[model samples]
Target: MPKITSLAEPTQLHERILVIDILRGFALLGILLVNFTGAEIARTGRLDDEVRRLLDFLISSKFYTTFSFLFGLGFALQLLRARQRESRIVPVYLRRMVALYLIGLFHAILIWNGDVLLYYAAMGFLLILFRSLPQKLLLAFVILSLAFEFWTSLPSSPSMKISGLLPSRYTPEMEQQKELDRTLDYEKSREAWQNHTLSTRSGTYVEAVKARFQVWITGRDFLWSYFWATAFAMFLLGLYAGKKGIFHDLVRRQRLLRWTMWTTLPFAFSLNLISAYGPYVLGRFYQQIPDWGFSLLYVLAGPLGSLFYVSALLLLFVKSERWMRRLSFLRWVGRMPLSIYLMQSIIGTMVYYGYGLGMYSRLSYLVGLLLTLAVFALQIPLSRWWLSRFQFGPFEWLWRSLTYGKPQPVLVRRVRPAEPT
Candidate 1:
């Protein structure tokens, strides 16, 4: 751990944990690697087709799962935090989810329909039913649920091929496009999802159905489903770790850390890396894996890798002043994640959509990541500067205000401690 020589008396913000901000920082950076692509390609672009399957595979196949996995971790942290607060956990959690659901509803309609917050909020409701179950049973529920998803999600013909071969396409603009639309039907919707065109406007009814299902039914299943299969499991495991105070209890922490590293390093270096590389190597042979199989990998791989990353980051934060200072900006961006997520969605849409810069399918995945970094880099400084003078980013301010039904203090400043020594 970094020496606390500078603080001599650094204030404790929480009774026990500050890992939420740190973990969220890592997740925020990790998630944008994919969301930027979707926003850049689909929301912004008016392109007839998106042919970058390899890039999509990398982002969708790997990064988004990582994002979802970390989201579970964050959720687990929230629950753990509530336990510490001695507050009404259920009502607080429910209220928070309701707020998120409302935000997600507005977000999907005005912005991107592929929002995950709605699913998360919906899933929050389902997971409640199992909150009282024994840990072993809770885990079993996760496994069986995932198995069902995999079994239900059997492989089908490639969506692109199905769509490309179709004779019926309907766009108000082109006869050529109507021919394209005919081929996408009959095949499972999943294919179309993997290779769907950005500019392809479904009639209002189709968009509405997608919104309803994704926001309600499918979203709920996926949220709790992933929660149990990935985050909740890690959370239970983390809860165990926290309850034991692994770091404070060095021998136990060392043992846990050693095992965690030994188990996860190979996945980071091998499994995830391979999963990232598989589409390129396997080419057309890289049909998607079953959801259950993917879930198992997520539990085994993504969380493990995330653990390793978290451990490294934590130890670094504790021990290295320069490293912590350098990362302070990223940590700031993480703190205002709500604002950043929506901002990226909005700006990214404008850039690709007809409304703004209109950059769509034209950018490659690698370039999109670079572009994401550029945007994040801007936010790091901006957030730092903003937070230096304010308590919350603008959107965060509103979320806090709505959730608490009171305007949160916005600016941060050097001030006397609230409590007496």
Candidate 2:
């Protein structure tokens, strides 16, 4: 929540915690991979089902969880810094959250329907409410939240089964009618989607926006408590990590990191493997809904995998200069996360939409993967260049400016040599 005034450049502030930036940068790349996968699944049948499965097993849910954790960590760190400066934290923080929500709304309605920013902004507000709770209480809340999520998502618990059986059995005619209705519904939904795709491909900006908003509205779940609870739980875990200084010094935490990596990763991999390939191996029932066991396994494994990834990456950053140098470009993208995130939506849509390149259904998974890497690789240099001349990423600057009710400086100052004395 600290304002980036002209007195101290925003670019310089990041120097103190380069690891967070690097982790953020790493998360961005993973995000692109999953986004591309989702885009492929939405518009076209999986180009390579194997690739999709591999991504599911390794990448799908991990990075977003990482981002959520980092968001919470950022909140805690910002609050501490605010206190140090004797600043009123809530006012600035509230403004920042509002700005984030606005930007997320713009992105979700106008650019991409897959936006997570709005959800993040909303959860961020809840995080503010609980930030002052004792650490033990926060951890307890986190566990309860995750448990709540798992409970809500249960395909059919005993209580649900009992309630479900209480409904009278449908008559033969009614059952037949229900089947017909479901068939008709599927056809209607499919037609709507086709039209939506057409609009996105060749429509004007207004048409595209309308199409996105319609799709999101049609698919929105007002009662999706499980997902919301899971997200908040991740945020709380992040708060706990920040409070514990787990990420403050990778070297000092090496043993903890190793223990996490060694202990959690194998089970994480095993659970995900089952989740990803269970249907093929076990039976079709494994693929059916209300398989609470598999769902719980998946939900539990995701955070563990995410933690393993973070610990491994931190160890690499602290131990190997070569790996650190290779991954340094991530810092550039990480620093301007808002800019880069929106940029991905804009560029990705332009590349795949009918109006731009119209490569949506045409692209194979391999091509999509290549495109993902290419776009991110291009962003690395561009972000570095932008940050070199500007104090903040464009959106970050705007958000900070709006939060403080004033314009923040963007361009770097050019120092002139002193005249000979």
Candidate 3:
């Protein structure tokens, strides 16, 4: 074990992983693109359809998987550090989660209903339960979690039939009632969507807040039902990688990464391709594919695609200095991911909300894409400049301060000259 340092100290600059930051920076771009296009006021027309399809194939689910894995890896690193320092991990980690939850709560309630930080914080607590499991047991847990997610994502017909075998008898009246319920649910969902769009685009700040709260409430079921398992699985995968030290020496792991990347590339591409365009293509030849089928495709594709992306990035960084320099800006953004992420939401809301330019649903996907790129391009230089003078981003400093129960120095203090000795 390494010698203990101050337990409260954050990871020092020299001890940081350059590749992780770069990968995070890259993931942020994808996340921004998805969020921007997804938030558009309108999503109709051939051009929009094409763009959406492209995004679905190329970006959807991939970046979040990466982020989730990174989160787990980060936790593993923290655990390792704690072990080295002979410190108990639970109290400090628990405080961090609580602080994160509070921050996410504020972001969701006041800024945007689509906030993911709150969900991440909730999952972090669950992660603590598996932290001490042996590597094999941890791997088993990840596999089982992903398997459960895939099973649940399978078409509902089989499960529905199995469920029908219970005490309740199927009847014509029951079928009629079920149909009615389905219709009512569809109408309710459509009405809610319309209300949300209108409120965000034109309503007052208070009205928007109310609408956001309602949307967040309504989304809780879906979030828990669909996302929780897959996200946790990715987190475990990251932990697995961290424990195995897969990322500690990219140079030594080059051959393994190359093999994994090449092996997974075909499946990732094929699965995502089918998920993106299969419905339209297969619909012509057979019955329409169920929504669950596409969802399953995504579940399978997400990790594979993310793995390929990470491996490719690592290889590129390790083998090519030119590429590394070009991508170095991502490190700045990665270093302060929390601040950048929240800033994205704030900027996005300001641009789309009623009190701002009110362009919520009015922009085309292409325009939104351009705007995402523009905003991120601007953020790169801004982050670089900020990091040059500060030890952490504003929000990062706050989170760290809260987690450690003390203020962390934000500015870079230059070396002081010795007085007359």
Best by TM-score: 3
**Per-residue lDDT of model 2, residues 1-421, tens digit only:** 5454332222256334788899999889999998875654333455577777888888877888889989998888776666556666787788889989898888988888778888898999889989889899998998898787677667654222233336778889977786676566456555656667788767767887877776666533321333677678879988888877877777898898889789988888877887678788668766564577766885687787888898888888878989988888789999999999999999888877766777676777777878889999999999999988987899999888877678987887677999999
**Top candidate (lDDT):** 3
Query: Can you write out model 1's per-residue Cα lDDT over 365-407, one digit (the tens) per residue?
Result: 5567678789877877888798778877787777666666667
Between 2 and 3, whose lDDT is larger? Answer: 3
In candidate 2, which residue ranges exceed 4 Å CA deviation? 1-16, 41-47, 157-198, 216-218, 222-226, 280-290, 414-421
Pairs of residues at least 3 apart in sequence or in different chains that clash in candidate 2: 155-290, 201-354, 201-355
lDDT of each: 0.55, 0.78, 0.83
Q: Candidate 1, which segments miss by more than 4 Å at Cα?
A: 1-19, 38-85, 129-252, 279-304, 315-322, 413-421
> What's the TM-score of every candidate structure?
0.66, 0.84, 0.88
Q: Model 2 misses residue 91 by how many Å?
A: 0.5
